[model samples]
Target: MTSGPSSAALLLLADGRLPAGGHAHSGGVEAAVVDGGIRDIGDLEEFLRGRLATSGLVTAAFAAATRRSCPANGPVPDGIITELDIELDARTPSPAQRAASRAQGRALLRAGRAAWPGLSCPLSAPHQPVTFGIVAAAAGLSPADAALAVVYGAVSGPASAAVRLLGLNPLAVTALLARLSPDVEATADAATVLSERPPADLPALTGPRLDLLAERHRAAEIRMFAS
Candidate 1:
């Protein structure tokens, strides 16, 4: 019999259909599409890549750090998780982005509670990545697994949004995601390594463009996405 942790839980968390309210937000893609920053599959790839390198990295590292802060078989540390939340808030400069993350976090927390009935999250409304980390830990996933999930979602969410916003071919978008897998793995690995740093020392890579896009999306009168 296998004694190691199973990958099924990780897969469940990463699945887009997990009812985490990820569908409502495009991760800034809708605003970018409205702003003419992405017009085709090629532009979408570039945008996803940029996101993977910037906010993606920060999110992955913070998720990994949060996972590390969680104990394997005990109550979650509220103090450490609170510190991580504040650090994540600091890293995310845009108010719209922060609100969007917390909204998703709340949704994910509900899903997490459903999946793991005994799950005890410290924060009522944690950031999305922090919630992801806490849920990942409860599901018996490693920090590296949590990091990979965040980076993958970071790109995949925008990629999926591009399909609806631009009418891009689903096959082409899937192919584009396949092509970016290596970079995603590398980014996740880097994030996992950086997770060893203190909460305040985690990667603070900011995406000013994404922040502006989020702000613009928030103000759009007839927008499809909430963020």
Candidate 2:
């Protein structure tokens, strides 16, 4: 039997219209822009590319793995999912970033559960990927689709922030997304590797500079984004 949700379901999860409170967070782009790392559309695009390669890829992998491992009619295995969440948490290394991630995850969970009833979501502290996987599974979406949605969300959220901060053209933003499509797919493929085994078996790779940026951003007296 097939293990994916219908196209409509995938669209719902991927749609920017979903009330997941994603727009409230900038995914760190605002801070980067303010710090001079991103000045214009080009810089924002580059930042997104690097982000998609590292944190973006990792999140997609975990979400995909969770979706694949979760059964349709039962609670997902806590050991596996919690391990993945902790891995993400540990890699983050920034208390601000961790709090921001968990905040978004909890918001998404509350909204998603209400929007789509009969879903099995854990009461444990949710990281973004864990909530994503559970929501995708509940919606009958496939791991691959869930992974793509996550990667797309990660990319777009920051890009949107760039547009507002830098005053970039919306059309340019859309084109940037088009250019990143191949990278997104490639990242999704890399994420799919997680389906082969649980998150614990995966090799360790974390970005330290990003963590520092998150921490620095938090300490700043003036800030537009949460983290």
Candidate 3:
């Protein structure tokens, strides 16, 4: 039998139905839509493209880095995870965005640890990408697997949101995702390349509009998603 987590584990983790509170988040897509920014699937496709290139790239790298920081079948170094969290916070400029990330991280951590007792995440609350990487390590997944998970979730979350917000056809969104698969694989591989670097060296890509929208979303009177 193989020693590490199987490819099926990747499928399970990447699925949106994992109950990680991801459903309540549009990954900032809702805020954009609320502002009359994204009108339909065409706009959503653009948003997804931009997100994948910017925040998606950076988060994927962080996931890979977090996995590298975690010890595979060994004790994790104290304070290392904390440092990773701080670095991620520096990358996230908005307070609301940070909170949203941590909440999801905590949820994913709970699920990840419970699902795989061998995995140990020292941070009580880490950034989502960091938790993903460390959990990937614990589950015997490679840095590439972590990257795949990160990039996939980054785009998929917003795409799912587009369906609900714009009342767009689900099949069209699925086709859009299918068309973007090659780019997703490329982004994951790029992120995997940065896995061995220190947190400081990881990419610091940002989305100013997404950050602004996050703050707006937090203060809104009525909203469907959490972030």
- Against the reference, the lDDT scores of all candidates come to 0.91, 0.79, 0.87
Clashing pairs in 3: none
Total backbone collisions, model 2: 0
* Runs with alpha carbons beyond 4 Å of true place in candidate 3: 1-5
Q: What TM-score does structure 1 among the candidates reach?
A: 0.97
RMSD values, in order shown: 1.7, 2.1, 1.9
For residues 1-227, write the lDDT of model 2, one tens digit per residue. Answer: 12444667777777766777787778777777777988988888888888888888888888888788778677777777777787777667778878888988888788778967876665455887879888888877788888888889989888888888788999999999999999998888787776566566653556665677788888889877777
Model 1: per-residue Cα lDDT over 53-156, one tens digit each: 99999999999999999986789999999999999999999999999999999999999999988789879999999999899888888999999999999998
TM-score per candidate, in order? Answer: 0.97, 0.92, 0.95
Evaluated at residue 77, the lDDT of candidate 3 is 65
Count the clashes in each prediction: 0, 0, 0
Report the candidate with higher TM-score, 1 versus 2: 1
lDDT of 3 by residue, 18-52 (tens): 97778889988899999998998888989999989
**Model 1, stretches more than 4 Å misplaced?**
1-5
Ranking by lDDT: 1, 3, 2
